[model samples]
Target: MTSFQFTKMHGLGNNYIYVNQMKEQLPEEELSEIAIRVSSVYTGIGSDGMILICPHCCTCEDAHFQQ
Candidate 1:
């Protein structure tokens, strides 16, 4: 089994699972599947959704560009 670290955060009753993409890499194709599993109350971590914490640098090709 694959193992990674995550953090759970909530605000005004809404909650989400956070994964640090800068520290760990996840398969891009499986992102949707992973989200569904982790968001399941009976089979997984149970959250409204998953959030990926990406690095903010030009070197990171997948990183979002900010002005």
Candidate 2:
């Protein structure tokens, strides 16, 4: 079985499963399926949804940075 680490967090009674993509990655094509599976209360980690914390992509030219 394939497994990745995750953290569960909540605020104001809302909760979600957070996956740090900076440390690991899931296949882009399977993200929707993964979210559904992980969000199931009876079969999975049980959350309102899944959140992927990814590294910042600096490749976007339109992005502006302020000091």
Best by TM-score: 2
| Candidate 2 residue lDDT tens string, 1-67 | 2488999999999998988999679987888888888888887878998888777788774533211
The 10 consecutive residues of candidate 2 with the worst lDDT sum are 58-67
Q: Per-residue alpha-carbon lDDT of model 1 for 2-47, expressed as tens digits?
A: 4678999999999999899896788878777888888899879799
Instruction: Evaluate model 2: give its TM-score.
Output: 0.77
Model 2 misplaced stretches (Cα beyond 4 Å): 59-67
Candidate 1 weakest ten by summed lDDT: 58-67
